[model samples]
Target: MKSGCQWRMMPKDFPPWQTVYDHFSRWNKAGVWECALDKLNERYRHSKKRAVPSYAIIDSQSVKTVYASEERGIDGGKKIKGRKRHIIVDTVGNLLHVSVHRANINDTKTGVAVFERAAEKYPSIKAFSGDAGYRGTAVTFVEERLKLKLNISTKIKDVFAVLPIRWLVERTFAWLNGFRRLAKYVEILTATAENMIRIAMVRLTLAKLP
Candidate 1:
């Protein structure tokens, strides 16, 4: 899946396309991918001298879906028809939580889901940061329900200056983009797409280890 080639286009040296897909589907359903990601993430955290993240950052990206599916919608702002990936990352850019929804969903609405998912897993997470898009009701919802500080970093005067704190999540997104399959939301199922991200994180965490 990482190769970005169509399953039917898989090379002869690889396992039969159907065989490979069956394993992928089965593992996704069994939550093996998420478990692997959590273990690898713990290793990466220890490598950086941290036990768990004290705070997290949230962000979303809209990508165009390749096939017609009920999981897609039009992102009027980006003008793309597909889905939005709402992801929360730690200070060092490790993924903490990820949720997918129709691109048309507002950031504030999905922000709640992302924070709740992270809060459930990481009790140490006391705060999170995001761009102006996460301000207003989203900020209030997270703070009230999840009891996490929501920092809204406004744009700076310089056109090219990177925003503080929030940039970490953006870098993580870039890291995920390195996996060609994630360059677009091609998976027919939302869970499969999310599992693909976990697989990419597993590869990243392993690569960072000596």
Candidate 2:
């Protein structure tokens, strides 16, 4: 994953490519990657002397998708034809939850599902920070449906200053770029794409543990 090499192109020093891919596919289907991420996130948070996070930063990224039969579409705002991923991260940048869908889907609609899943898993999260992209129905959905607050960070134009609370999730996406495989959506299914991201975070969180 770090090298982003194709499955069959994996170095022979490792196990057979099929063997490695099988284990990865099985784990993805079983939710092992997410479970490990949760356990390791808790451990890392405890090491930092933090409590279960009460707030998180939410953001979405639109990436170009491979020309395939995958469920991909154009993000009119970004003018990119691909899939969009919504990722939620804690204040310290640990990944909380992620979801992938067609780029044409509205952020508010996707944000609801992402927030719901994360809230169910981490009930302590009572609020979230996001940019103006989630303005209209997003804030309302969070308050009414999820019983959570969505704080839209003020957008400062003509300048590159970082928005403290919101940039953390953007940095997480930057970290993802380090993995070449993530440069584009290559998986045949969005569910697999989502798990592929979880797998990337699992590697990152594991490194921080020891």
Candidate 3:
């Protein structure tokens, strides 16, 4: 598909299709894709019409990887070879931050990175919502470092209090899955995998424009 696009568009001066594909392949390996996503998110924040986010949602999803090595480790939860995508989404389901880690990495560990990064990037973010997996140190880190509040959604009598807002983050995950690349894991390197995710998000932001 990429080769065909290059052939039709450039026709005469185009570099070899394999070379172009190789560049993208290499960029993914080096984590350029994820960096691109970060830049896009930065741009989005600067140009956004809404006021700063008062809250965000946090969660992790498991994606299956075909090339599993001793380095990546095993995921007992999914029972498949893969990695975890830890993401933070805003009240409107817009992605604010993300981290990719080995499937075996605990959700709480990745949660720290996600919140810290988000706090650094968007200082106005004041609160976060998530499940019990984010209960202990995860809650403390956000409070101590980010100086933000934590709102955990549990099966309590006050479920109604949390349901409306918490769903935004879940909806964001569903929106991200709309991109087929995210639906299946294909990248060889973690950086490249993150780049695809960033691209999907940038595309989403652009789509929302008038």
Clash-forming residue pairs, model 3: 33-195, 34-195
- Candidate 3 lDDT tens digits, 1-210: 212132225465768767776887888778676667656655665567566766888888887765742226567977756788888888656677777777887777679888888888888888988888888888998888778888887855754554667677777778877776677566666766677677778777766644
Give the per-residue lDDT of model 1 (tens digit) for 96-145.
88888789988987887787878889999888888888888889988888
Instruction: Compute each candidate's TM-score over C-alphas.
Output: 0.95, 0.95, 0.76
Off by over 4 Å in 3: 1-15, 22-48, 68-71, 156-162
The pairs that clash in candidate 2 are none
Q: Please identify model 1 stretches exceeding 4 Å from their true place.
A: none
How far off is residue 14 in model 2, in Å? 1.9
Q: After superposition, how far is residue 24 of candidate 1 from its true place, in Å?
A: 0.7
Writing each residue's lDDT as its tens digit, candidate 2 over 24-121 gives 88988899988888888999999888869999999999998888837799999999999999999998678999999999999987788788888898
Predicted structure 2, TM vs. truth: 0.95
Preferred candidate (lDDT higher): 2 or 3: 2
Find the 10 residues in a row with the least total lDDT in model 3: 1-10
Model 2: CA > 4 A from native: none
